[model samples]
Target: MTVAKTINRKLVKTITQRSLSTIAPQVRIYEVGPRDGLQNESKFVPTDIKIELINKIAAAGIKDIESASFVSPKWVKQMSDGVDVMKNLPRAPGVNYPVLVPNLKGYDTARQCNVEEVAIFPAGSEGFSQKNLNCSVEEGLKRFKLVADQAVKDGLRVRGYVSCVVGCPYDGPIHPKGIAKITEQLFEMGCYEVSLGDTIGVGTAGSVQRLMREVLTVAKPEQLALHFHDTYGQALSNLLAGLEYGIKTVDSSISGLGGCPYARGASGNLATEDLVYFLYGLGVNTHIDLVKLMEAGRYISNYLGKPTESKVNRALGDRFKNHNDIAKMASCDV
Candidate 1:
C-alpha cells in the first residue's frame, strides 16, 4: 500500500479504537455568560441590557444560568446592578438562576433578591487567593464556609468554585493534591456541586487528566463540574479529558466574553457555542438549540460592539454566508 493509504488506515484504526468507549449520553451546560462573562467589561452594561441578555439565554433553553454576582460594586462596578437585574428577571419555570456570592453580605443581598442558588469561589493557589480575595487561602475558605453555612440554613442550594485548579498566574503550576483538598472541603461544607476552574487557562489534556484523577479521589464525578478558559486553546481538549473521567456538567460563557480580573493574561471562559458544537459531535445531548444559542451570542456581542469570540459561531456564520451566495447565484442562473 502507498504511504498515504497506510497513514489513512492507521488514523481510521485509531478512531475506531477510541470510539469503542462510549461518551456520556447527556451533558448539563452551566451558562455563566451574564455573570462571569460580563463582569470583566470595562464599561458597565445597563441593567436592562443584562436582564434582556439573561432572558434571551434562558429562551435558548439553558436551564442553569448564572445571572449576576452579589459582590461589592466597589470591586466589580459592572455588576453593581445585580439586585435590579435579579428583581427584573423574567422568571421562567424550570430555569434555575444562580448568583455569585462573595461573602456573607453578598449572600444576604442574594437572599433579598430571592435567589434559589448561590455560588462561592475559593482560589486553589495561596498567592491567587491573597491577591484576588485580599486574604490567605485559609481565611478565604473560612469566609466561604460561613457563607455556605448560612446559605444552606436559608434553604438555598450552594455551588462551590475552585479557581486556578491547574496553574496560577502568581504561583505557577498547582499540585493536584491541593485541588483535591479544596474540593473535598467544599463538598463537606454542603456545596451540592464543585466546579474546578483552570483560571489562567494554562491547562493541557495531560495536566487536566492528572488533576481529575486526584480530585475524583475526594469527590465523585457526579459532584463535580469543569470550568476552563480558552486562553491557551486547550479548553476543548481539557473538557474532553473531563468527559472521559465522567464529568457531565461544564461552565461556559456566551460569545466567549469575560476573563478573570485577577489573572491578567487569562482569556474568557470556554464559549458555550463551541462547547455545544463539540458535545453534539460526541452525541451528547445538551438540550440547547444551536441556532437560538447563536442568536443570543450575536445579540450580546453586537450590543457590546465586539465580534464573537466563539470559533464555532464564526464558522457557522461563514457557512451560512456561503450558502446564501450559492442560492443567489442559482437564482441569477434561473
Candidate 2:
C-alpha cells in the first residue's frame, strides 16, 4: 500500500509538471454570457438588455461570444428573442457570434439570421441525456449529427457541447471513456471544437485531469474547451488543471449568470471576471480588459437585481473604495 501510494503521487506530480510546462501563451475566452448565462433566468430578460449585454462584452474584447439560442420559446422563454438579439446587436468586425441550435429547425432559423457558427448540446451521461434532452444519448447524438452535417454543408462552423462530462446529478460519476467516445463522434461529425462541461459543478482538479487525459486521446487539446460551474467552488482549479493539459479555449459567463433548469441543485457558471483575473495573473494573454469586463458584469448583475457572483469583482470594488476614502482623508487635511 505504501509503495502504491508513492507511485500514484509521483504519477500525479509528473502529469502536473508536464501540463504546466506546455501551457499556451494565450487562451481563448469563449464568452457565453448572453446565451447560456441568461437562459436560466426566471424573469424574461428584455431583448434590449440582452443586446446591450452582448455589445458590452464585445467592447470588453471578447472575440467569441454566444449571442443567443434558437431553442423553442415554449421551452426556453428567456431566449425567445434569440433572433432579435442577433439581428439588433451591433456586429463588430473580427468578432464571431455563435448561436445554439438544437435541431434542424433552430439551425434553419440561425442560418436565416446569417449566423457564422452554431453549437449543438449533447450530454455525456445517459440519465442527463434523457432528463434534459428528452432522448437517449444515442438518439441525441443522431439528432445533433443531422444538424452538424447540414450546418457544415451550408458553410457554417459547428461546435459541440457535451454536458455532464465529469459527473451527473441524475447519474453518478461518468466514465471517462464515455466522454471520450462522445467527443470522438462529435469531431467525426465535423465539429470544429467540442466543449466538455461539468454541468452540475461536481468536478475537482483530479477528476478534470483524469477526464482530459482520456478525451485528449480522441481529440486534440486545441479542439477541446472546458465549461465548469462554480457550485463546489472548484471551477477555477479545474480550469487550471485543464490548462495544464494544453486546452486553450474556455467557456465562461459574465457575473456567473447560468444554471441548468433541468438539473436539480445545480449552480451558476464560472464567472468571466474571475476567469479573466486568474488568466491575467498567470501572465496568459486573453486580450480582455478586466475593468471593462467587470463593468459588463455589473451591468448584467444590476439588471438581474443580483449581486455579482465574482469574488474578484467584490475584492476590486473594496479596493477602489479604500483608495477613495484615503484620497478623501488627504484632501481634508490639505
Candidate 3:
C-alpha cells in the first residue's frame, strides 16, 4: 500500500496544505527526557534533581512531557519514585504529562496518582520480546491488553509503543508485516496512538519509509508517532522519512541522554534541541526556546557528570565560551 492509502483523507489534505505553505507552522515535540532520557543512567539521579530537571524543562515551554514510569522498581530503578515524581512536579498548565505503565498493576498505580495518560510497549522482534519482557509476542499482547483495557475503563488515554521496529539486537532484521501486526493489535486494544521505535538505531531513511508503508496500512498517521534513536547516526534521516509520510508527532529526549542496554553501541534518542533546530529551520514552530532548552540539558548533564550527547548542545557551548574569551581579550586591550 502507498502512503496515500494509509493516511485519512483529512490528514493527507492537512499535511499537503501545510507542506506547501512556506509559513507552515509548529511541530509537536513529545518530550521523552524524564522517562526515556534517564532510563539508561548508570547512577541514580537524586529525586530532587529529577524534579528540578522536570521543572526547568516545563519552564522551557515543553507542552508534552513523559514524566515517569509506573513499572516495578526492581526492573527500572530510575523510576522507582514514579508516584512521587507525579505528585511533586509543578504541573505545566495545559501540558500533557504521560507516564509509562507496564501492565495492569502499573495502570492501577497511575490511576491512584490521578494520571490520565499512560503508555505501554511491546517489542517488534521476537527475540527482543523474549529478552525485554520474557514472553512471546502473543503473551506480551495479552499482558498489554490488561493494561490498555484498565486504562480506558479508568478514563485514561493509552499510547502504545512497538520497540525495535526497524531492527533488533537479537533479531538481525525486521519485516514490515511484523510492525503492522503489533501496531494494529495496539490500536485495537484501545491505545489512542502508537509510537514506532527504532530501539537499536539501525534504520535508514529508505528502509524506514518502506517499513512505514506497511505499518500505515493498518494504522493512520494521526494515530501514530515516530521514536528514532541516533545509534547509527540515522535518527534524523529516518525522521525525515516519517515526515515525508505525514507523521506529525515525534518523541525526543533533551540532550540525547539515554542508550539501549540491549545494543551496546547504540546512541540515545534524537535530542530535543536538535529537533527544535531542525523544525525551526524548516519553518515549523515547536514553541520551544532552543537556548533555554540547551541550558536545561547542560544543567542535567552537569549533575550526571557527563558530556552531553547532543552535537548541537556541544557546538552551542563552544560558541558561547569562544565569544566569552573574545570579549575578555577585547576588554584586556581596552
The candidate that wins on TM-score is 1
lDDT of each: 0.89, 0.89, 0.84
| Residues 1-334, model 2: lDDT tens digits | 6999999999999976676677788999999989999999997899999988888999889999999999999889999998888888889999999999999999989987889999999999999999888999999999999999999999999999999998998899999999999999999999999999999999999999999999999988899999999999999999998998899999999999898887788889999988887876666778877777788989999988989988878777534433223333323534
> How much does candidate 3 score in TM-score?
0.88
Per-residue lDDT of 122 in model 3 = 91
10 residues in a row with least lDDT, candidate 2: 321-330
Instruction: Give stretches of model 3 more than 4 Å off.
Output: 1-25, 318-334
Model 3 C-alpha lDDT versus the unseen true structure:
0.84
User: Candidate 1, which segments miss by more than 4 Å at Cα?
Assistant: 1-22, 318-334
TM-score of each: 0.91, 0.90, 0.88
- Clashing pairs in model 1? none
Question: Where does the lowest 10-residue lDDT sum fall in candidate 1?
Answer: 321-330
lDDT of 3 by residue, 258-292 (tens): 77887879889999878876665565657776667
